[model samples]
Target: MGTFLGHLLPGSFFILYASWHMFSVFTKYFLSQRALATTRDQGGTGSSGGGGSPSTPYYRSTCAHVFPCCPRIPMEGIVKIVLTTIGFLGELITAFEDGVFVHYGNAQHMTMYFAFGLSGVFDIKVSRGPRPALPNLDYVALAMAFAMEALLFGYHLHGRTPLDVQVHMLMLYTIMLCAVATIVEMAYRRSVLPALMRAFFVMLQGTWFVQIGSILYEPLTSPWDENSHSQMMLATVLFCWHCMGIFLLMAFVGWLLNSRVKRMLGTSSVYCQLERRLEKGSATCQEALQLTEE
Candidate 1:
C-alpha cells in the first residue's frame, strides 16, 4: 500500500500536467492570434497574418486552410490543442481502467465516459491540423509526450498491477526524444549553439529510455512479496525511469514558459495591439482568439 501511495502522487501530477498542457495550448493560440491581429492592425512589413485565426468556422469567408510542405504549418497551434484533449481522454480511460479514480467509489464507468467526452476536444482540434509534428515535429511530439506522461503519472498512482506501471513508463520513454528535440529547437530559437549539439544526444537518450524501459518492464511486477529485495530493486529502477521521463517533459515545458510561446486553439487574436486595424483583417479574423483566462 505504501508503494501504491508513491505511484499515486505521480499520477496526480500527470493529471494536472495534462490539464495545464491543454490550457497552455489555448493560451498560446489566443496570445499568438492576438499578437498576429495586433501585428496586422499595425500591418508590419513582414507580418503575413498567417492563414488567419483558428476560431473561424468552415468556409467562413476565407481563413487559413490546410496546406502541404509545412504540412498544415498554418494550423499547427489549434491542432495541437485538439490532440491535447485526446491525450487527456486517453489518460482518463487509463486511470479508470487502472483504478486511479472512483469518482465517488462506484462511479468509474460514469467517470470514464465523462473523461472520454471531455477528451474529445483534442480530436476536434487535431482534425483541423495536418498530422502531428512537421514544422519542428520534435516540439509537437514533445507536447504530445508531455500529455501522455501526465496521464500515465495520474493513473500510475493506484495501479496495483505491473501492467499499469510498465505501460505508462514505456510511453514516457517515447516522449524523451520529443522532449530533447523540443529543447534543441528552443536552444536554436534562443541562439545557443551548444544546446543544439546536446539536443542530438538527448534525442538518442530519449529513444534508449523507451527501449530499455520496455525491456525491463517485461518481467517486473508491482506487488512483489513484501520482503523480496529484488522487487525493491526493480521498483527503484522504475522510479528512476519515471523520474527521467519527468525531467525530459519538464524541460520542454520550462522552455515554452521561459520563451513565452503562444498556447491556445483557434480561440481569438482580437486583442493584439497592432492587429486590430487591417482593412481586410477583421473580415478574415475568427472568434477563436478570445482568451478565456477566467
Candidate 2:
C-alpha cells in the first residue's frame, strides 16, 4: 500500500537515527569508564583522561573527534536536519500522489510536516556549536512528532480493514511509549534507561512498519483476510511474536556489550585495586560482626 510505504520511509529514518543514538550513548559510557579506570591507576581523580579534558558526561558527539579541524561544528545535528528534511519531503510526495492533500487527509500530512520541520530546526540549533548540551527543544520536538503520528493514524482508521487497523493500533501504542519515555528523560535527567527504551522502541517500530508493508503488499504471503477471524487472530499473534523477537535481539546485544566492557575493566590495574579494596572492606566487616557476637 502507498500509505504503508509512506510510513516505512520515515520509520526507516527514525530507525537509523535511533540505532546511531544507542551506539553513541553506550560507546561513550564504556569509553568514559575505561578512561576513569586508567586515571585511577595513574593516581588522578579529577575526571580528565582519554586524551581529552573533562567534559560533560551527557554526550560527546563523534563529529567532535572525527572532524578535529572544525570541532565546534555539530555534524550530527546537520545529519539530523538532512534526514528529517528527507522524511518530511517523502510524506508530502506521498500525500500528493494519494490525493490526500486535495481530500480529507490533508490535515494529517500538514501535521507531520510541521512535526518534522520543527524537529529539524531543533537539530540545527543544537548542531550550531561543539559540545552541545541536550536541550528542552529537542524533547519538545519529539513530543510533537509522536503526538502527530498518533493523530494521523487515528484519523485514517475509519475505512481500514481489521488487519490494517490492528497494525496501526500497535504503532500508536509504540508512539505513546516513546512519548512517555521522553517525558521520563526530561524529568529525570541522569537516567539512561528511559532513553535506551525509547531508542529500542523506535527500532522495533521500524521493524513493524516493514512487516505491515509485507502483510499488505506482498502477494506471496499476505495474511490479511477481513472475513476470517482466525486470520486476524494469527496476525495479532505474529505482532506479539515480532515484539518478543526484537526484545530478545536487543538483550543479546546488550549482554555481549556488557561482557566486552567487563573484559576491558578486568585488564585494568585500577579495577583490580578497587576490587581488592572492596574485598578488604567486606572482610573487616565480617570480623567486626564476629567480635560483637562473641
Candidate 3:
C-alpha cells in the first residue's frame, strides 16, 4: 500500500459492504418472521371459517428498498460488482504507478485482482435475472477472497517493521475467521450467528486497515521508526484501542437495529392481531416465532 489513501479507499468500500450485509441480514430475518406470523394467523382464521382452504402465501423478498432506483436488482450483488471493480482498478493503477509491471513483482496485487474479478462474476451468476437454485457460488467467491488475503499476509511477513507485521497477522486471523464463518453459513443456512460473525470480522478487517494507515501515515503519531521498547508498547496500545472502538461500534449498531425491529413489530396491526391470537390459547404464532428465531 502506498499511503493513507491507498488503504483508506479500499477500507471504506469494505466497511460499506459489511454495513449493508448486516442490515440485509437483520431486515430479512425480521420480515421473514413477520411473514410467518401473518401466515399462521391467516391459517387459523381460515380453519375456523368452516372450509379447509390453503392460506395465501406471503413471499418474503430480499431488501431492495435500499436502492429505490432499481428495486428489482439485488443491492448486494451490485455493490459486490462495483467494489470489486474498484479494487481491481486500484491494483492496476498502483502497478502503473510503480513504473514497470515487473518492478512490483508481488503476487498480492495479482491475487487480489483475480479474487475481486472472480467474485464479481460469481455474484452476477447468482444474483442477475432469476435467482439461482444454488447460490453457494457467493460463498465460494468469499473463500477465494479469504485465500487471496492470506497470500497478502505472506507478502507482509518478509522484511517489515514489527508493528506492520503484527497488523498483518491480526488481519490474517480476522480473514480466516470470516472464511470459516462463511463456510458455516453455507452448511447451516438457517443459522444467523455465522453470517453475523462473518460481517463482524469483515468490519474488524476494515477497521484494522484504517489503523494501519494511521500508524504508517500521520507524522505526529506515526510508528514508522517504532523499534524501541517504549515505542512498541505504544503501538500495541494503539492497536487495542482500535479493536475496542470497532467492538463498541458493532454493539451500537446491534442495539439500534434491535430497537427499530421491536418498534416496527409493536406498531404493526398484523403483529398486534397475532399477539392477541397467541394470548387466546393459539400456539401457531408462538411456534412460528420460535422456528424463525432458530
Candidate 4:
C-alpha cells in the first residue's frame, strides 16, 4: 500500500466506514439515554442500562426497514463483501508479475481485505442463519479481522525509507488499539464506551493512513526528508495531532446527535400532552351535553 492511490483509496474507505460506525454508535447511545430519561419522568424505575431500549432497539444496520420485503438482506454485509472483493481483485491484478505472485506487500494488502470480506460473510450468516453457534459471532469476526489487519501491517514496513517506516509504525499503534478495542466491544456489546473507542481508533487510523500518504508522496507540496531525525519527530507529533482532531470530531458528532435526539423527544412529548388535553376537554363537553339532555 505504498503507492499514492493505494493508501488514499483504502484510507478513504476507512474514513467513511469509521464515520458510519461513529454515527450509529452515537445515535443509539443518545436514543437509549432519552428513553431512560422519559421512563424516569413517567415515574418508572429507570436504571442505567447498557443494552438497547424499545425506543432505540439494537439491530445491525440493514435496508430492511426501508424495504420490508427484503428484511433478510444484510445491506452492510453485502457492501463489505462487494467492495472488499473488488479491492482484493485489484490487488491480485497488480501484484502479479508475469504469472508470478511476487509482490509480497500487495499480498499482505490482499489478506487485510480478505479478512474484512470474511467478516462480512460472518455478518450475513449471523443475520440470516438460525441461532448461530456462538452469540455475538459478528463481533468476534470483526475483532479477528482487525487483528489480522494489525498483524499484516506490522510486517509491511520492510525495505522502506526511514520516514515511511516511522509513519507506518505510528499507524500500527492505532491498528493494534483498534483490534484491542474491538475485542473489548465483543464482550460489552451493550456498553457504548468500548464501541466508541473502537470507532475512535478506526477514525484515527483512517486519518493517519491519509496522512502517511501525503507525507511520503507530497502530492501537494515538497517531499519530506526521509532520513532526517527532525522529520521523523515531526511525523510523530503529527500523529498526535491526528488523534486530537479525531477526538474532537467524535465529540462534536456525539453532542450533535444528542441534541437532535433530545429535540425529537421533546417534540413528541408536547404532541402527546396536547392530545391528552384535547381528550379531557372533549370528555367534559360530552358530560355537560348529557346533563342538558337530562
Candidate 5:
C-alpha cells in the first residue's frame, strides 16, 4: 500500500481535503433549525430567484441533487463550489508557470511547520467527540506530521542543482500546506473549527505527488539521480508514509465530525441509549442523595 501510495502522497492529501469541504456544507445545513434555514437564501445558484438563470432549472438541478432533501442548501455551498473549482485550477496554473521554485534552502522548510505549531493554538473550535477540546493525541500527531513535511523538504533541497529551484518551490508549497494542515489539525483536535480553510490546500500537495510519480515512473527522469539517489529514495518512502498519514488524518477528522454531529442532533437511536444510561446514573446519584438525608 505504501509503495502504490508513495506514488500518490500529495494527491491523497488534496482529495481528502476536498471531501472534508464537501461534508462541511452538509453538516451546517443538517444542524440548522427549519424556520431559520428557510429564511436564509438557499444556494446562490439561482435557487433564490435573484436573476441569472430561471428558478425552475436551478431548483430542478438542486432537487436533482440529494443530501439536503429536508434542509435548505447551505449558502456556504457558494464558497465551497468556488474553492473546489480553484483547487483544480492549481494543476493548470502550475503547468503554465516554470513549474519550479527558484532558490531552495533547509532554513526555508523549517519555518513552515513552525507556523503550524503557532496556528493550532489560535483557531480552536471543537466539533467532535465528548470533549470541548481536541484530544491531546491529535497535537502529538500533528507535531509529528509537521516534522515529516519539513524533513522531506530538507532532503529535497540537499540534493538540488540550481535548476531544481522551481521544484523546490513546489516542495515549499507542499511544506506550507502540510504545515497549515498540521496546525489546523491541532486546532481541529482542540475544536473542529474550519478545516475547510486548509481543505482546498490539498490540491497543491497532490501536485507534489503527481510530480514525484513523474520522476519515479514517468519517462522524464530516473528514480535514482547521482547527488542523492539513496536519500531521495528514503524521501520517497517518507513522502508516501506522510500521504497515508494525511489520508488517515482526514478520515479521522471526518469520523470525529460525524460523531459530533450525531451527538448534537440526538436523533440517532444510539444517542437515545446513551441518554438512558445518563438518566440511570442520575437516578443512582439521587438515591445516594436521599440516603444521606435519611
Candidate 6:
C-alpha cells in the first residue's frame, strides 16, 4: 500500500461509499419528512417523522440504495459485497507471491477489506431476512467493520518514519471516531446525526488516504521530507482542511435536498387544496340547479 495507486484505490472506494451513504441519508430523511407533512395536511395523525421504526421496512441507519429504479432492492449491500470482494482478492494476490506470505502489508489490507465485505453480507441478510433484527444487526456489523479497520491501522505503522507514522496516526484517529460513531448509531438508530457523523468520518478517511499517498510517495509532486518538522505540521493542517471541506459538503447537500423535498411537498399540497375547492364548488352549483328546476 505504499504506491500511489495503492492508496488511491482504497481512497476512491471509501469516497464512493461515503458519498452514496451521504446521499441516501439526506434523501431518505427529507422524503420521510415529506410523508409526515402530507399526512398532517390530509388531517391524519401519523407516527413521529423520526427514523423509521424497526418494525417498518426502512430507516436512516439502513439507508442503502444503489439504484433509483429498484429502490426496494438491497442493491447497496450487493454493491458493497462485490466491490470489497474485488479489493480482498487483489490484496490476497499481492500478499501471496508464489504461495508465500511475502507482502505482509497486503495481508493487512486484506483483513480490512474482509471485515467490510462481511459487514455487507450481514446487511443483505438483515435487509432480506424475515424480520428486522432488534438492536439493528446492520449497525452492529458496520461498527465491527470500522473497529476492525481502526485496529489494523493502529498497528500498521511499526517501521515507518516519524512523518509517515504521524500522518497515519491522524488517519487512525478518524477511523476510531468512525467506529465510535457507528456504535452510537447502533444504539440509537432513530437519530440521524450519528449516521451523518459516520459518513463524515468515512469521507475524511478517504481524502486523507489520498493526502498520505501524495505526501509519502510523491505521486503528483516533489517528495516531502520525512524528517522535516514543518512537513509534519503541514500534514496536520491539511487534515483539518479536509475535515472542514467535508463538513461543508455534507451541509450543502442536506440543505439543497431538504429544499427540493419541501418544494415538492408544497406543490402537492397546493394541488390537493385546489382539487378540494373545485369539488366543493361543483357540488354547490349542482344543488342550485336542482333547486331552480324544482
Q: Which segments of candidate 2 are over 4 A away from where they belong?
A: 1-4, 40-72, 93-107, 129-135, 258-294
The residue-by-residue lDDT of candidate 4 on 142-212, one tens digit each, is 87888888888888888888998899888888888988988887776557788788889988888898898
Candidates in order, TM-scores: namely 0.28, 0.71, 0.74, 0.81, 0.36, 0.83
Q: Of the candidates shown, which would achieve the greatest lDDT relative to the real structure?
A: 6
Off by over 4 Å in 6: 47-60, 132-134, 265-294
lDDT of 2 by residue, 1-294 (tens): 255675567667767767665654454445445645554565664443576433222222221111223334555556656765665565566556454465446446556656766765665564453334655666677677777777787777898888778877887888778777766766664455666777778777777777777777664564567657787787678778877986787677666765666566343342332222220112232231122112
Candidate 1's displacement at residue 95, Å, is: 19
Using lDDT as the measure, what is the rank order of every candidate, best first? 6, 4, 3, 2, 5, 1
Instruction: Quickly count the clashes in candidate 1.
Output: 35
Q: Clash number for every model?
A: 35, 0, 0, 0, 15, 0
True lDDT of residue 189, candidate 4 = 56
Tens digit per residue, CA lDDT, model 6, 1-294: 879889998999899889988877777666555654554665543332345211111233443443545434667788889998999898887777678989988888888888888888877776566555474677777888888998999899897899999999999999999889888876766578988998999999999998889899896799899999998999999999999999999999999988876777363443232222220112232231122112
Output the number of the TM-score-best candidate.
6
Off-target runs (Cα >4 Å) in candidate 1 are 1-115, 118-227, 253-294
- Residues 107-207 of candidate 1: C-alpha lDDT, one tens digit per residue: 33233333333333333344344454534343343445445444544454463455445544544554444345445544444322323323333333333
Indicate the TM-score of model 3.
0.74
lDDT of 5 by residue, 143-216 (tens): 45556665666566554443244444556666566567646654443233334434534544665656555554
